[model samples]
Target: MALLKEASNLKLITFAAIQERTENFSYGELDASNKPPPIQVKHLNNDRITGSAAQKFCLFRLFPIIFSDMVEHLKSFKIYLILREMLDIILALPQRKSWLPYLETLSINFQCMMLELLPDKATPKVHYATEYTKIIEENGPPLRYWCMRYEGAHLYFKKIAMQSYNFKNIPKTLAQRQQLRQCFLMSKCRFLKSYQEASGNKIIYMHEIDSKVKVLLNHRYGSQFIQSQTLLQCSQLIHNHVIYKQHAVYVYDLEHVEEIPVFFQIIHILKLNQEWIFVVDLLNTDGFSTKLWSYRVSSYDRLDIVSPNNIKYYHKGLDLYKVDHFHVVNLTSRLTKTN
Candidate 1:
């Protein structure tokens, strides 16, 4: 309390509130849809966060979820919102050319906001924001040249070098450790995987499946014998190291801009014919709720079977949040380049 009072010039009260919210923020394990492992970034505001770039990026993406309920009227908080828009632009894969102007506008707005609101705190990072659109224009999307993987790869050697206490032939020691680690990891099933794979333990008889899904499958297979077979289905399916669970929402269509961000909820995860099939219920996007930073959706009874490989956009799915008797999806980014 004393320290916070002494730092009144920093608006520590708001900072403390956000820190408390972040510390208490919780989500289910199935909620991992490109979500980074949980990290306590409260200390990061004052002290350096000792983690990889991926971890930082993860926390950064979750900022909207954490600070969504904060005072929106705050001048500085608007800067955070602008930065989030920039993040969405930067992190996108197959970055579109149309987004460059919007990115430049956001970057300029971010810099001006920082200078106008917190004059003394304007840093070089803010200035760097201006050059993003220019660089992106010349070299194409900056994500094409991202070095996050390279940065992450260095962390392993750093840990080994700092902890081994072996100064002699340091390069050789790192090489030996790297070889052993890679060898062990590569020996495992699906390590550095390039193929689609799925596993689940729950078993259910086909006759016991939902009447609607059973009917749909039977019609597709041109027989009623599907009811005679058994199914190995689970509430959650681990596909290529990513978790896809029943009831989680995923992007199923990204072709048409009108329906570009279509989503479907996995009503069931089934394995048949040596392939993973998701029995899903397509969801219609109602609208976006900025207050929650999620998309409001309405579920339809129409059921369809889709292979994970068939998904056109980002494969990682978003868990639904029930707000005001409706389901909402917190997608990391928009496919529309103008966003």
Candidate 2:
């Protein structure tokens, strides 16, 4: 049965489809991406999924195809919508004061839904979740004060101290070790790996490129680029530490924090004068398909060129799928705007 055309909003799913839920969604470890890292199937399969993994799974993986199970259980689906909106506003740091009121309403609705559907399962954590809006309004974005990064660093030093048995003057030992490591990194020039790297087996030259792309290049760069014998081209781009592959989704426009954002898929990755350019096809921004729990986007024929520097969010790159006649994109993360 097809959706967005047929009467079926909730479709039956296979067991394999359920098993591959987390497997189907994956993202890189770029900072500000706030995406869950690559997880092993065994560790995250079935009962093994709990704690932070469950939260990550709920916020990232589970929502994409949630509509399949929502029709029969409308109350449960209402909870999902509330949580989805909660995530969109909360997890997206730099929480706006204006959105806090709407967040309060979402939280209240979520509480009522939980009480109505599964009151026995509602725990203290749910209570804490309701306070997020108030906390943000009083203390600013919670992510700004998150110690996870610092905790990771501390763990590294803890391992070193434990292995070396350097308890005496631990601070001094840590300082010396860090200094040596810093010197080693500087000497090896590993710190400069932040530069973009073009990946893919095929190498494309200017003449070998599409006529439309050539026109775009000439129109934008003129002879400065047209005179060049060849241009650097690739099917994959690694910039700002995030991996962007051809046809992958990235936010082109975050119109409003409360509204559904617009996305564009990278049609081409080209480089000229040491700057990377992305030729992209904009996704239709009518709104997300609530039944699919994914953004239903009709691909555009007209191509637009954008720069990596001009990207609003550098951290997350989403995946786009061809679902029947239209395309759908599963956003594995929130739209947290950044320079």
Candidate 3:
């Protein structure tokens, strides 16, 4: 019965057999035409599959086939794998819980393979500028294959059609098309946000380390230790500890809860000393609320923060092979200064 129904559907569509003399669709033929081809709107009156289900089916089947075809066609071609931040990509996925895990797993696998093929050094540097320039630099191929953030997709497509094929102008009017294009760009943003939120939550467990740091400092150095000490003895103790000695140290003063001053101090300290500092918020929950106020300290100047939220960002940036030292200090107690 299923096979019969499928055959009946195939029979309904009109099929045309092409002779050997038929002209294949080519860029030259498309360009030589005086006017743009008519955009056909297929009006389906029947209540067939829902748009969402059809989209899922098409994505699952047709998308894979398209990628396979692309790979086959480009076997001799140099492909550029343009990637956004992982958090951004994750946030951009559809919000349905049922599909998220699978999407995440697939994205991770794809990213790993892409990175291996084109190592970081081989890929062009990412910058916010003309999308075409970035794409051209990243790949050896013509500019047509470069992909970018959805915000630049329309401009990219427009440029490709005009420059690559010498098309005068696309028939579609900007006013008539802007709404649909914007909708796609916005949808991409939403998808990215969803994945970023999920990824951010996954790293929330680091808050445990913050809590432990607070407790350890309070117990050993006394409650008023941070206020009295010019330099945190606990930090030296951390340096002495096997696990934390190599990690760059940053101390946050809970007393000054404002954003600019704190950030200025952090930036100044880093710039003057040329050392990356691992930031620690001195205040409890209240200080964590502001996005701009928190500090990030690291050993390397080029260290990138993985988390979108500022509070959870901390240093795990140490060479594990080096010998480490640990010590404990009381911030309230006066001690002789030593180099």
Ranking by lDDT: 1, 2, 3
Task: Determine the backbone clash count of candidate 1.
Answer: 0
User: What value of lDDT does candidate 3 attain over all alpha carbons?
Assistant: 0.27
Which residue ranges in model 2 land beyond 4 Å of their true spot? Answer: 1-17, 20-55, 66-74, 147-202, 206-208, 222-229, 235-245, 256-260, 332-339
TM-score computed on alpha carbons, candidate 1: 0.77
Which portions of model 3 miss their true places by more than 4 Å? 1-177, 185-260, 264-339
What are the C-alpha RMSDs, in order, of all predicted structures?
Answer: 4.8, 6.7, 23.8
What lDDT does candidate 3 reach at residue 109?
Answer: 47
What C-alpha lDDT values do all the predictions have? 0.69, 0.65, 0.27
> Candidate 3's error at 119, in angstroms?
46
Q: In model 2, which residue pairs have backbone atoms overlapping below 3 Å?
A: none
Give the residue spans of candidate 1 off by over 4 A. 1-20, 28-52, 158-170, 180-194, 222-229, 234-247, 255-260, 323-326, 336-339
Task: Show the lowest summed lDDT stretch of 10 residues, model 3.
Answer: 263-272
Tell me the tens digit of each residue's lDDT in model 2 across 1-339: 111111122345433454464355543322114444333434433323333433455444434453344333443555666677786677665455777898898898888877877676587877878898888988887767756568657777878788888777888988889899889878966356666777873657777878887788789889897689876678788776677787677877777656467888788888778788898887777667665566777765677899987776633676665544656776644564543
lDDT of 3 by residue, 194-270 (tens): 23111111121223334444454446447553443222112211121112222322222223323211111111111
Per-candidate TM equals: 0.77, 0.69, 0.17
**C-alpha displacement of 231 in model 2, angstroms?**
2.2
* lDDT assessment of candidate 1: 0.69
